[model samples]
Target: MKNISKFIKIIKTLNFIPVLSVFAISSSCSNKINYNSSTDYENNQNFSDIDERDQVLNIIKKADFVKFDSEDINKIYDNFNYYTKGNASPYIKIKKSLQLFEKYWKIDKNSEPWVINILNKYDGPDITIDAINDEIIINKYDKNKTQEVNNYVEMFGDSIIINKKVCNFGYDKKIKTSEYGFKIISYENDILIPYYIFNTLFLSPNYINLYYDGTKYQLFEKIVNFDNKKFKNFFDCAFPGITPFKEIREDSYNSLKFLMNNYYGLNKYYEYTSWESILDKYRDAMLDINPDNYTGAYFNFFNSLNDLHSNIIIPSLFNYRIKYYQQSNKRKTYAKLDNQLKNRRSLILENSDQNTNFFGYLRNNLFISFDEFTQNMNVKGKDFELKNLFLSSILKLKNHKDVNNIIIDLSTNGGGDLSIMLWIAKLLSKDKEISFYNYNDLNESLIKSTLSESKFSTQYLSKDFIQAKNILKSKQVILLVSNNTFSAANLLTSIVKDYDLGLIIGAKTGGGMASIMPTVLADGTSVAISSNNLFLNKNRTQIEDGIEPDIKLPYDDFYDFRKMEQAINNFQKTK
Candidate 1:
């Protein structure tokens, strides 16, 4: 089995997923991006007017973005080596190459965006990458043959070097971070195809000199493998030129502050710890480190985040947050909860009515195992009528007289699409009410806009789900959850608990309640922060501790059939 532990499923999501390809950016990195209503971040801004858009546009347009063809890139490499001759050392090349890559790649940190790239051989707009592997499927709703590719990719600290390269690497991750950094291929005539895109825009960006490091020579370059032509740039410096320490420090501080203010839900978990205090601790820690040590200072800042998602990849930086990044190789279980999760499949009851089935599982008691909030293939936004399988399955159970309770297994699930969550919530509600209000960090305009739109993206419609009724006329629900239940899944659990729609039967969910917002550092590095603290209602039903269960059943090796029966029976007595 692949050694992937998801409890610490830290991610780099802009809206929610950050491991995605930077495919939506424009061709040129230097040209300023015009931030419009469409730059999705899970939530949208109510942006007072077009002026707000213009204001953002004016700020970002200062940068000139450009694209370098393969020939241009090859020429630059040739010229640099020719000029340096035998005199240049690898150290010199390293520094010079960085500058050259920065200039030519137009890697303006404030504007680069990462998006899911789908190179479909058939027709249709590509499916966005909200989550990878689990939620992402190729041509999910299409009738085309699987597009062939050399099932090949090289992984770097930040970006994946696919056969369809975005640009030549100065180091490795630089090409992917630049405005011309990501690519996708669309196949029409059966042969493999290639296409590329980059997002070139930013607004109210606090630009900084991120590459300026005082202890420049201390940079560990061994981790990177430079080709022969590129290797000449790494010159052994006879004249050591260290970047000023103050420069890196100032950049780090300014960028950190801007991120804190923009993260809409940064204060939502203040009860857990204050963002200000956390920032202070890290900022203070930076002082204790060697002032010239930008790497250490930057690592410390990254390590101090309350957001696990923030623990994603930073270019040239490996697993500095080892506590969070390291995944367990062994698939063994230790805790009682772990045992329950391990044995969850065996413990579930087989449906009495085999006719009621969903995604292969027999929905006897109307069990829908929503492993992820992924959309079905051929499923379009708000087009629930086409991909409303879960709803139809639940409604199928309603026709049966014996079905009185439902079980939704959200165990081992990481969140996916917001629309999936909303649609499900709408279907489960008996009173035709919204399950919860979602918002983005610091953007009050977005909260108001979300209130107005009542949907996350402009792609959704209230009408699609308006027809959704209580799939269960009056049946109770038993949610099977654990620490794995997170993000949009956590929101669903809370709604179930808040609305008294179900009895949470397992461990408490891992609350990833706030909207995950990705912000770029001055170095063009991006990571996601839990920016919005949303609520189901006025009670501010908590998202952090996750939804509490009515019957807190610890996991057991053998399925606790008696306990389940007792809990269900006990609930029926009360009802």
Candidate 2:
């Protein structure tokens, strides 16, 4: 009977779920490619006049010679580690072995078809010999195969070489951020074979004869080679020394900016049809790269990665002004609306108008400084602290009068503590039981517990919910929101819409709506990933697209509030 009653209670709670919302957008830390027109390639005879050879020659001539230094090798290795995977336990052994090999390998000029060591197995496409032409020919496209080839005829006659070698770690061992460094492979067979293996891998490619001669070699564009031994060098040249993760991330952004400015012109890539308008001024730098080909190249690059957070930012110089203005406007608007918010504070209790002898109306400042309030408390799990503080203040003002109409000024709240949003809402609601569908990843092992595990389901917990639901039933709230209301704040706004709890009046909330996974590597370096999908309400509408507010109110419009206040005062007098 007890169990039955408990289940009934649970069912009831699920039915009356007070609009679950969160403005807090979580992000997975993204620690972060390609090529060209084929029609221009098939017509090689026309290309000779196109200075193709000379172009290659000039690139080689101007190409920066990157020496193999210990630091450079380490940087390359570091980068490789982030992308590749190795045995869970044997990574240390593998890295050590590769480092030793890289230290001994003698690097010099004229190492024909430069060979990168087979730190692991090369498993991409391989070449196939042709029968009719008495010459090698590689199949351009082959599905479910591990080999790629490029066959071309040079002045000397037929030439066959391998174009790409896709390598993988130990069988099904996923690549991680650390154990990705590689060792050099042999430069035999007219291909740079990094010691890796794929199916039917002994073969090479039959590609068109396109050579980068010594004169043109200097002008050839350079590419980064990653291995345990080359990571430090890559870091020093590309970014530089052990620095904060934020700084390293900025370097990646800058690198992308340079690529956009020099390689692909913006105007050609993202005109009215593309993201160029969104890019605004940065479009000019993008146009300078290759006005005609920039759009195609940028799109190709943007789609190269599957990670959601992987992206390209033009440059800080271009984005800085826009960001400054946005922030400045927000601050000014928040200040103007401060008094209106102050005037609407009310008591949280039921029918306590007579208690006015003890307490007056509450203050309107809805924003609380996290750093100041969390001084002594262990904030890690103190999700109820802020809302409880707000409720306690409201209760003190309950003077035996039923104060149902209220205003929550969320303009300055940057959003924190999801439970707090729910709790505060509960103070105004009358529902004894509020319910929401409990959704979660059953694979607990997939969840990284070091940062947050049980916390993800805090909203669904029974004990943590009742107070907030009760608050929502009786109070008709007008939440003053703005762009500053983010993450949990946004979630709160979403709840209002979904549950029909209240109305949101303000600018659009922040757009970050992804859930993140915080991880700490062996080196103590921490990073986050967006592993789980999140939703807004019980119906499970994914939150990444964000929740739309019921009413749109511009933060800059303060005069509009004076009229609203006057109307409310008149209604109060009539009552």
Candidate 3:
């Protein structure tokens, strides 16, 4: 009984999940990439015709190369060790890591050279990062010698200023580091910079020996090799360093356990699974920690949690696991659901005259649908085009005076921007204000928490909203949802239901309400977990378990527009 009590306590305190692993580092840390020594730096003779050779040269010369002395490097190492004490929680460790990165690395100003170098190496667009002037100048190399493009991204304090406007919406001034790189974190969202850029520029020899080396240039070379059809180099780069296998295993296990224990919101709700027992079962098999063994253990652990929002984000591990999933029949449910959603969307497109999959209209009813809230995953900036498209779609629908219905299909949407979702809710609702609450486990204690609510008013100046209101005043609004409708999409569905803005039809939504918190492990592997921000309805009830449909339909009916139309019509007649 005492042992049982101890086991339970362990289970509660150390919320264990399988963490995906990749070759973070191998024993060979000193080996350098053999770049062509003949490559000229002064004249930029190696640069392609498409490259902004002069601009790149000028940027590199202007940007100072920051070098750390031995003492400075030691201090960074000591601080990291002090912050990531064995007793400290993962949240504290992560927070400390961020603070350390910010203190040691003046990334905001000094990051220009590294950014430019990366772009140049990748054969990316001819771009210039002028830190002196505090602007990122992008010029597309057009063969036609078209009018010179002068797109600029500027920096002001911690905010990213673009075109003289502050583009930092969901960003706070705090710098958060991940394995991929670092990001500026806001309470609601984050803008992630590409991986390895930070470490490539800042990591010193001492730091590399004690901590992890990012090996940015080496990784880039591997990517180039892959592009050139040299697959071996790409795969070999996965495990570049000489870090001991045993140490890697231990660090991976401990870090994942710590992260999940403190930050994962669904811990109390999920059935306790003894990760110790699971690990012990795989202990002997995983003694030889190759990619296969490492991946198997971590993959199983992650799979056990059944949490979509939480997972490891190592590049090589992701590549390995994706290949694994492709070959294996495991997790077939997700695959099937993905295929079903694709088929349904394809069917809708086939039936409708919509040029794009984003939105359409049929039989005087305006249908708005998009799979993700983001316009472009690569561009970490405001998407004016997406916003314009959404607004124009509403206006187009409203222009049809005979139309008396608006149908929003979110069955296939995996979710994206929270702000966009709220905006959609505000546009459709009759109420002047829409309110939702969030419960955040700020202390990482999982007990004492903070409850906060956000209230959005229908104050948008878009003329489309006026038209939207007119349409809402007369037309029936219907929301189509399914088990696949997740994250922001699910949240949108919940708002529509709670506010009585529309009649919801289809199936229960896939719930993923918590904002994602990304952090790096001790091994330098990046991972994201479902944060402590548990979303709540108007009554303060948790919406993480998913919102049930007002009128559930057969799964097949979601794909059949005719059936959906018939159902909506019948429901209206009954009303």
The candidate that wins on TM-score is: 3
**How would you order the candidates by lDDT, starting with the best?**
3, 1, 2
Give, for candidate 1, the lowest lDDT window spanning 10 residues: 191-200
| lDDT of each residue in 1-575, candidate 2, tens digit only | 00000000000011000111111111111211012322211222232332331121111112122223334421222211111111110011122223323322222233233322221122211122211122212222223443332212121111212122211111111111111222222211222111111100121010001111111100001111122222222222221122222222222223233222212212221222233234444434333323223333333344432222222221121111121111224334434544333322212223222111111233332222221111122222334444344545444334524555566655545443333444443444343223222112111011100101123323333442334444445555766666555545555566666666666666676433323222211111112222221223434343434455555655445224554354445544775
Question: For this target, which candidate reaches the highest lDDT against the unseen true structure?
Answer: 3
Candidate 3 lDDT, 389-423, residue by residue in tens = 55676767545777766788787777765545555
Backbone clash tally (model 1): 36
Score candidate 3 by TM-score against the native: 0.57
Better of 2 and 3 by TM-score: 3
Candidate 1 C-alpha error for residue 67, in Å: 10
Q: What is the lDDT of candidate 3?
A: 0.43
As a TM-score, model 2 comes out at 0.35
Q: How close is every model to the real structure, measured as TM-score?
A: 0.49, 0.35, 0.57
Clashing residue pairs, candidate 3? 18-301, 18-302, 25-241, 26-241, 26-242, 26-243, 27-241, 27-242, 180-195
Ranking by TM-score: 3, 1, 2
Reference-based lDDT, residue 249, model 3: 50
Q: What local lDDT score does residue 180 receive in model 3, on the 0 to 100 scale?
A: 16
In angstroms, how far off is 121's CA in candidate 1? 35
lDDT of 1 at 325: 35
The whole-model lDDT of each prediction reads 0.37, 0.28, 0.43
Runs in model 3 with CA error above 4 Å?
A: 1-211, 214-243, 271-288, 315-323, 326-331, 351-356, 376-384, 441-460, 466-470, 573-575
Residue 115 lDDT, candidate 1, scale 0-100: 27
